[model samples]
Target: GYRTLRENDTGLNGALEIPAMRRLLPDLRGKAVLDLGCGFGDFARYARAQGAEQVIALDVSANMIDAARALTDDPAITYRHASIEDCTTAPAAFDLTVSSLALHYIADYPAVVQRVFDSLKPGGTFVFSVEHPVQTAHPVGWVRDADGNRLHWPLDHYQQQGARSTSWFVDGMIKYHRTMETYVNTLLDRGFQLRHLAEPCPPAEVLQARPDLEDTVRRPPMLILVATKPAKRK
Candidate 1:
């Protein structure tokens, strides 16, 4: 399913989230990188192409790991079948860690944040994207008019936080919902320096080319952020 969506380039990840996350990414040359929830090894391959010395990519799904391995043939990139919740990393082992639209699926946000902090070298960057809280707050599909024209995105249960099930490639896919405040504060509590936060929309040229994405302009669909582990106190 992931390979189908990615190969077709029909998902929002290719059009929006990846661009937004890439803008905030630090230089990868000679850096050690980690990719959490890496699907199809896109980011891992990109990191290696950017000159990263090594990349460790992990995903919970064995199928995804197998697919990634099949798609990749790089000595510097290692794909592991593991869940972010259960995986542990050597302290200060990586110069950068990245997740693209994957964090929202994890229920233990704080624990993951702590692990990412621990896994990064001082001043190392973590860049990730998740479904925007507004989208996650109420994940019911778009409200439509009589002709099935999308009227407006709905919003409710903003304060509620927990697992939300919705149909994606299959039925009953679950994603965790948390407030924007929770996301930022969790990083802050773990001593990460907040560097950038973005609710990005497709650029004008993209919108012109793919008019179907106009609804995304009306309400942001994803949030991308950058946080850095503070350098050890001098």
Candidate 2:
């Protein structure tokens, strides 16, 4: 699911990302930026275009990193092939570190969030997007309806806190899910102050293009968050 038809590879998630970027860009221009799980470098390039001084795109997937390198050769952007949990980036090196629709894929999300927190300078920003826990908790299996068309069961299922599926696979990969409160608290505990929390409302343009899943466009499909690291104490 994550590797298929997403905003990173194809701008589908841009509906969710563009809005978060619009809201967060004012603070991002001319700052050092890092993109966690950067995919094929879409948002990293987007950050550079929006005026970030430098952008580093990092993801655990080597194939994905190779795909990213092939797409762009800008000097301002660097692509790193490494797991976010294991990167040795200098402490407090970035003005901002962001992940778009990527954090939930990490098995231990809170630890990695802290790692991202530790990577930034004082007051540096970290923004990210993830599938709605509600989407994960109550999954709809495709089946034939009474009219023999299409229908889904268990609408509006909310996971209080859990991982419901492992849809994204490459020889059996593991992933996770977290409630909004679980997510927010992890950042707060790591010294980040919540700045913005967004539930996307995909525009009519997106619906018109992807008519099959207009349902996602009619109601926001994901959540975005922006949090800031406090400057280190003397």
Candidate 3:
């Protein structure tokens, strides 16, 4: 079963993530797009509205796919039930592939990145967001004082990367933890040209909207990666 966690939140995903991605994203006019881990197809709908020629949105959960399909009525957008690890596409089929906060859940990142690289056209772009290494470096919370006052976040086992369990909308959610080097070098090794990276802090407007989120500015929760596939040689 899938749960909708962030849709109700107005702080990070709505303000920081979407705005950061839009800043780096090239024009979407008349392009074939792929939305990996397309939960409820929000980005897919946005791409279609932005004039994408076609959009293929895929998710590992059937409930998510069903929700996306029911909410989306456009002929240009197709939602499929598939995992990022197992999903395949025609070579050089997409002009852009965008994912939002989903990669950390996948354990086989290298293989999946290779798949994404293979699925894109020459010079195509892949923009994605994931949990930041600092946040994922350890699953433990901040060490507070005797009064339970705030304290600093802890970093442990950073060099050791593997499964990290946490409770979100549901209990016992599992996600993979990889170092920043692993993330960047893996893409480079797979032939992706890293263009931009972001560890976004909530902006002033977002802070004003939700003052409690001020700490998110100091502690970056998410990381954004923008990479491109090189054009074929002549």
Q: Rate the local accuracy (lDDT) of all candidates.
A: 0.91, 0.75, 0.88
- lDDT score, candidate 3: 0.88
For every candidate in turn, the CA RMSD to the true structure comes to 1.3, 3.4, 1.8
**Candidate 1 local lDDT, 1-234, one digit each (tens):** 657777676558778878778778998899999999998898999989989999999998899999899999999999999999998889999999999878998999999999999999999999999999999999997999999999899999989999988777755558999999999999999999999999999989999999988989988898887999999889
Per-residue lDDT of 38 in model 1: 95
Scanning candidate 2 in windows of ten residues, the lowest lDDT window is 7-16
Models ranked on lDDT: 1, 3, 2
Q: Model 3 over residues 1-234: C-alpha lDDT tens digits? A: 344346656457887788888887879999999999998898999998889999999998888899888898899998989989889899999999999989999989999899999999999999999989988989677678999855777888899899987865556558899999999999999999999999988768768878777767767888999999998899
Could you arrange the candidates by TM-score from highest to lowest? 1, 3, 2
Clashes of 1: 0
Sequence-dependent TM-score of model 3 = 0.93
List TM-scores for all candidates, in order. 0.96, 0.82, 0.93
Off by over 4 Å in 3: 1-4, 146-148, 169-172
lDDT of 2 at 228: 86
Off by over 4 Å in 1: 9-11
In candidate 1, residue 146 scores what lDDT?
Answer: 95
